[model samples]
Target: MLTLAAGASAPSVATQLVGSGLIGLREGLETGIVVMILVAFLVKSDRRDALKWVWLGVAAAVAMVAIIFVAIHFGTSTVTGLAAELISGLASLVAVVIVTAMILWMRKAAASISGHLRAGLSKALAVGPFAVASMAFFAVGREGVETALLLVGYAENTAGSIWPLVGLLLGIAVAAALTVALYFGAVRINFAAFFRYTGVFLVVVAAGILAYGVRALQIAGWLPGGSNLAFDVSAHFDTSTWYGTVLQGIFNFRPDPTVLQVVAWAVYLVVVLTLFLRPLPAKPGPERAPLPEPSNIPAS
Candidate 1:
């Protein structure tokens, strides 16, 4: 059973895989789409010479993300007990904040992001190859770093298993394939609908992480009410069972949770879900010019 306390058994690979894979797919697709726009713009504009620099930027961003992920994952592994919980709790909270912001910002920015990227790339082309690469680096790097943070947060629930990492890679691979198909016009996706659905899923995941963070903090003595149990179903639920692991792995569900943790989870889920699923206000269209009035003698 995985609890806020240390030395719990790792979750089942299947459970970790699903959670990590979804995160990978969501973040990967966004990053890939951004890269696709930049690449497509370059190709259409006959700036193929700048392609190498874009690739270079992409490579750099990938490397940066890898380094960050490794550092956090390993760095935290070195600590034990309270220190580990504290670090993991803080990371989880940060991940939730960043991910929530990403989902919200993307909902509004999706329409204009392509144009923005193209414009920036155009400006970069005018500047130099280094600028072009830097543009790609920074643009892709933002998403990459966000992905790393999220994975690290999710990894806390994995109990040091590597299967989640494998799932993340698989998701990225699928996203890359999808992006390539999209670029070639071999596939059609209503990106608006796609992100909207995925955004809801991510919000739910973030709520889970938020609750986990709360519990971790409580255990670490950063928060009160560690002993104030909302309920204890551990005996009945049997977290070692497959079903139990699935719930715990994906949602960070505890058979027994502190009152604060349950409160945090419920509030976060309800408030965020409502805000996310609410209908977006219609975008105002460009105003049409008023027609020239009454030209009775104009023909003459």
Candidate 2:
């Protein structure tokens, strides 16, 4: 086990399991929903011939994401010491930015996404098989790339433990089952509420990651104030304990955080939370089509 400064223990294998699971669930569902939409559209519009192409695109996207994930997760293993720390810090920061944009964009786009997707698919059909496949590839690929990057960031926090990967796979499995259920009209969900709640959870997670990133940079000597203590509750709160593991795993909480970490965490949480929770500008309800959109999936 790698010894951290000031009596802070290295994270255990299970430390980040829950956080990774949630990320997988959210990202997997988004990817699944895109596939469901495209498939349903093709089926309903009598474009069954294009179904194979759509599947091809989805398969390609998944394969691409897997390759990217493997390359990234293992690539950093080659580096040691400060270089690794610097990479981890930068990667975590990038994940935070991407996840933040995803959260905010989903808030606005969720309402209109179905119509836009259908429209895009329609145009792609006119273009030919390659376009149709490319459309699905890009649509799902975006979510896949985001998921890969986020998972890597989470894994870095846990010192490359296998538990984070296990948690993510479990979450994706659940998401897949849920997506299948919804696709077959066996379940109904208020997607708006779902996204909103998950978005909030992710924002908190991202804030934690951002703080972790700042600490990493500081450790790597890329930033000053590594020893500038904001507060050290190491005596009172042991990170190796069960509760401590949970806190560190879920929120990246450190008993001895630097001034910069605390400031980054606080500012990000307050600003992003406020923006996320604020009422959105009024707009017409999303357009409807013959096939039910994700928001309108039927239960029973």
Candidate 3:
């Protein structure tokens, strides 16, 4: 049993667990969707022969991500004290940026991703197998790296060690199963609505992460005024309480946060939430195969 001193509390284990799970679910679903789209396009086009190459590319991407994850794990373990804090702060900031971009890009791209992928498939088919394989690699590889970055950031901040990893693994497993069902037409989801809600949730999560990044920087002495907190609610609200765990789990909530942390959190939430909730722009989708290039249609 770990002991906490006066006005000192370690991170909640449950919070880390659920937070990591959400990240895993979101990231896993995106990766699954990309692969599903590629596979579906090939099948519909009667290009079943190219499926092997696609799978190969996906495998290669997975292997690359696995290697990177392992390397980071070992490397972070060796880092300690101020160095670890500095690295974590920077990494968390990067993760927030990537996640924010992903959420916004998905908002715009979700509507046209299928069409764009199909068009890309058509072009890839015109090229060689290498191009097809490379296309799949790039598509899947991107999501894989993004997923890894999210996990890495979470891992860096977690004090409960393996609890976060367990949640992430469970979420990913659930996501994989969901993807398979969706691809086989056993399940149908309103992806637009799904993305909208999840995007909002992720924006909130990113704000929390960004604030935590500032906290980390302050702890590392990379930023001044670590002790200059805006308020100290710890006297009245104990983080060991049930509600505290809930808040901390969902939003990384702290009782007493530095002025910089509060400012960063507030500005991020207001700016990003407003931008994310704005209406999506209208646009033409992937040119629609040029209307079959009508010249000679068998001259019936």
Candidate 4:
């Protein structure tokens, strides 16, 4: 999408807008889930005071992302050719690491994430507002940083940075609106199902990012075997064409790839898919023991 949009003869302004909007949808959905979890904890615990902390965390994360963008934009201009390539390549590599960790963690912890968040909230509440804010900051900050890095990588690899960013923003807006609706019971979605499917989709996307990062490193001379073209399909398909543009934007498809790029893409898919497809352990059911009354326990 980014590549096609970045191309000289890709599409009209409206097409770019729609493409970016879809990208935003995916990005926003991911962020929305985290926000939903945070808000749910606040409402469940009756900790309206803690809500500010959540917003603080979100603001801090956004600020950090902006800083990154400014730094990259200015830094790229200051550095010479090789140096600039190295910086961008290294950044992409770092993004791959962050994205990979997030995927694996989510895969392993998806079943119990709610419980973990609840426990963290309990601890945060015990420590007062500052601690609550810090907790929220860290939680959301993790996701924000990952999103920022991924977006940076995407922007660097593809053409037309602003359009992709626009898409991302639109996605976030839609996701946020949907989340708010869900919170108020105005909307209903099978969250478990949604996460499950999206999780799979994310894994595929991460694989493409990993491949892209490796290619960037090759271009920067940080990796070897860049000279050899893995395969050429450009004779049959021009990436600048309408169908090609759509595929390029959504899947990061390139007609020409280096040997290392192909290998990296394949390895990523194999490893991630193997782990993703592994059957999860069955969750234990809730205990049947009688609950203690709220009045019976001493107040903190």
Best by lDDT: 2
User: Which RMSD values do the candidates have, in order?
Assistant: 8.3, 4.2, 6.0, 5.3
lDDT of 2 by residue, 113-197 (tens): 7777888999999999999999999999988888888777766666546677777888899899989999887887677777889
Per-prediction backbone clash count: 0, 0, 0, 6
Off by over 4 Å in 4: 1-23, 73-80, 286-300
Tens-digit lDDT track of model 3 for 14-91: 666688788788778778888887887777667899999899888889888878776766665668898878877888
lDDT of 4 by residue, 1-300 (tens): 223443345353334446545545555665665666767767656777778887887777778766876676566546767787777777767877786687667666656555566677788888887777777667766766766666666556455446666666776788778767765667666555565666566666666666676776787888998788999898998665677766565456678888888888788888877876677666566211111111211122
Error of 4 at 234 (Å): 2.4
- For candidate 1, write residues 108-224 as lDDT tens digits: 677667657777888899999999999999999999988898888777876667767877888898899888887777777767777888888788778888988998898899999
lDDT of 1: 0.80
The best candidate by TM-score is: 2
TM-score per candidate, chains pooled: 0.89, 0.90, 0.86, 0.83
> Candidate 2: what lDDT?
0.81
Give me candidate 4's TM-score against the actual structure.
0.83
At residue 171, candidate 1 shows an lDDT of 86
Checking candidate 3 for backbone clashes, the offending pairs are none
Error of 4 at 281 (Å): 1.4
